[model samples]
Target chain A: MARSRNHEQWTSPPPFTQEEYVDSRIYSDQDIFEEELEKIFKKSWIPVCHESELPEPYDFRTTTIAKEPIILTRAKDGKVRAFLNVCPHRGNMLERAPSGSFLDGSPSGNPRHITCMFHAWQFDMKGRCVYISRQEEGYQDRLKKSQMGLRELKCEVYFGGFVWVTLNDQIDMTVEEWSAGSLEVLKPSLDEEPLEVFHYHKAIIPCNYKLWHDTNCEFYHDYLHYHNRITGFNDAYFARKNTGFDNGHINVGSFEVQYDNYEGSHSREEISFPHLPPNHWYMIDMFPGVNFNLRGSSLRCDIMTPLGPNEVMIEFRGLGLKNDDAVTRRSRIDHHNSIWGPFGRNLHEDLLAVTGQGSAMNPRAENRQILHGRHENETIHDENGMRHFYEEWGRWMDRMPSNPDKPFVERTTATSATG
Target chain B: MSNADAVRDSIYRSCMYKDDMKWQEWLDLCDEDFQYSITAYSPEIRNDMIYLSGDREEMRGMMKMLPKHNTDHSPLKRHCSVYAVDLEDDGSMATAVSSVVVYQTQLDGINSHVDAGESKVFLVGRYFDKFRISDGVAKFVEREVKLDTRKLDKGSHYPI
Candidate 1:
């Protein structure tokens, strides 16, 4: 084919249906990004942190969902709770650190209480206001402690002890319902024994959060990962299915990785999770950006926070069985870090690609068509994972993905199986 | 040169070889059983984590495979300052502490038009290095990179 003229270059569309491509504006437009946070992220169930992260009473972790600060604590009753990390008095952020224990007293806080450094307000692990400086003298019974308690959010600890929270108080679905069985494939392995996080790191990538999730959704990009290409391109790998679930979740079926195919790489079979076949891998990409990947020996969870339309902060956690002996734990860490760590063989390459995409689709850049056109019987190389996700995204935003100017219309074809 | 100076020289040579992407030259400065690791303490998880670790042979294999993988070809210049060297009584072994600040020059890819020739700090860390001196020749036995910067943007295909 001859090279196109300038007008044709700008006007021509790819020879594919609307479902096969989405407008680049969905990734680079500030207005669409903010509306996504409100319509999709805020209303969806998000895994804030793992329950094991706050094992002891008064242990707390602070995070955000759709930019609303949240604090999760292990209360005296041994239940995990989530609340807005704001001092009701003046809306000051209550916890400044990423994580800590409230058991020790600070200069401005009492033992076993969440403290607001701005005004010295204190709340218990359950988020009940325990102390307020000069409450009776200043307000004079106008604001009681009962009415000043922290705003509690809906929280649940399930599906392998992840603490799932939602900013919407009236969300209709439970965490299980939200997952829609996307996690069933690895349920036995993940729930067989308690898990403990052995590694934690985060990177602020210059890319939209969905782009990172897109990386997780499909295995076609394995071409970009030499490690995966060398070890995972066998017939079994190509035959593995991409199963889409409701609420934008997708699962890549298990496939045995030939770990020893690569030079200096060792088989992870010996330390495979309980009930899991040696050398097998399974992955689940949850809606609005969360990934749970179970390689033979370790479980890696990626939680994304959209800092802006063109930037995202991804927290990476690697977990092993809590009862792992020192030697076993060391081996698990090695297996995890070998592929997924910040300096890992594969993750840096993924980050590099996404950052490239981000640079090309910055807010000022002209909108272009981003393709998702491949079709391969819903197998590993199929693009249905992303197509299904955008279908749901269009529903939530009530806008067509290919043409954001038009309202969303449901397609009649059954591109995905119901989870 | 003094035994301590020899060990310091070995450390400096390793940095230069790494900056030049001369993997074999860098490996030549290490002992047969040398261990290399990049570690950091994450306040988020309240734990010390190792991001990368390998023995000499494993390191060699990884470096050999670098060409097959997609990597950022931007050049890295490591500025290292050896702060202290403690020589053992026999002068056969020494331990050195140094501060490292790595700067990367963006020279390739899309941003080159705007960022080419511009240098940005890539990493800040301390190196705890141990060496074994044989006949006045020092080779690294172990090097632990304890990094202060945890949020490595886009990270690196090679070790820091």
Candidate 2:
């Protein structure tokens, strides 16, 4: 925590080991940010949207991943697909709105197509170029519509209500393989219980994307959130487990968070997803930036995409069952909004703390060490998930982090150093 | 004042209480059955979106705990223009539709020279409100803040 004038304190020989600390350079360095963008975000299976978002054929949702425009669509054949949302014909932008449907031009008299508002070039849901204007009169012999098609990305819809996309084609791994055993822990809720996104909102924070993920993995920051302190620090809360999966994914399974412990809040019912016991608090940090969380009566998914080195855009969604009655749905919405919304009891504080951390780390003037080495047999209090994340980050960047400067090194005095 | 005039005046006063950060005064204007929600639709995801929904008790608890929470200090001034006020045929409740434009001024650390002097438009929305008038005084029964803008900056804590 000390930014002493002596860089010696940073490189000091005998503080804590690499297990508990990460180099601050990862947060501040521009070159590292660029490397992370190319190596990690471009290759990871980023969560795009829920399948229900585009339930009808030819429906599409547009978003940006790592600063590149992307479109996820349910094609006419009833299969979902992903493509780069750019017009092939003059390289113009496509789909200005966040989402829309391909109209059957036959209504007015034309073929059905995902029409690009620019230059009127139309593409089918399968990324095929269907029509080009003034084709017969000019350049008919030179230009062929069949020869050009929109660039496609690897898209997969898993058992959970999420759509995952990746940019790299060289990799042969499937989304299920990448997320091995991660959804198994969620099967009782995600697999059997049907769900749909009930609420959607987005906000932009002026900070690196990873800063937001830190708020998810590190449970010690609960002290920063007063409302969480009231209902989250009980004995049952600490007796939890964090399971680390391959490829930087980790799931934290904890006992029920008794929201009823707080004065005005009420107890939860058995209306949680299929087979999920009341008060169950489960969360998955789906490596890179997609997160799925089910707390008591409601579920929320948050996915982030980097806008720049110092800014990130976060899309938040709250989910509930498709057939929930009015009472159950209201309870779900109430529970979700209380903890996950922009004005939630905890999210506002989380955003503030992360943005503040980003601002403090944005300046490279000081050498900072982020201490994540807390261990309580991998309880909710453990920082092992963070350690897992950075190890993957280090593998991608091909260099040891500069803050802690060592990944596997041990500092036996870590307990005292935390003092 | 007449009942309609009282309803309009109460609406203006409610906006004043919110703008001035007078939480207790604002709460006093609400009936026991009052409900407040901030809602918007995202064409990106779903047809109906509920950003924040709470009843009178939940709001009471929130206001009680607000001072202890780490909330944004940036002040917001809501500019409101009442468009239509209509009393129901049965006279049980009255409704008012006011177009609201909220400007957020960065006073603390997050607002630097880039956003120092100008109070930026934080959100543009309409307040669809229901009131119960008794003896020419109006008490808020329900207010649904249907926001047209979905993207928010870092610092919005209060209901818009």
Best-performing candidate as measured by lDDT: 1
Q: Clashing residue pairs in candidate 1, if any?
A: none
Task: Give the whole-model CA lDDT for all candidates, comma-separated.
Answer: 0.90, 0.78
Name the regions of candidate 1 deviating beyond 4 angstroms.
A2-5
TM-score of chain B of 1: 0.97
lDDT of 2 by residue, A166-260 (tens): 88887678888888677677767887756788878887887878888877877888888776778788888788777788787888886877777
How do the residues A69-177 of candidate 1 rate in per-residue lDDT, one tens digit apiece?
9999999899999999999998999998988899898789899999998889999988889898988899997889998899999999988889999999989989998
Candidate 1 local lDDT, residue B136: 85
RMSD in Å for candidate 1, one decimal? Answer: 1.5
Q: Please report, as a residue range, the 10-residue window in candidate 2 chain A with the lowest summed lDDT.
A: A410-419
Best by TM-score: 1
lDDT for A209 in candidate 1 is 90
CAPRI verdict (incorrect, acceptable, medium, high) for model 1: medium
Q: Cα deviation of A161 in candidate 1 (Å)?
A: 1.4
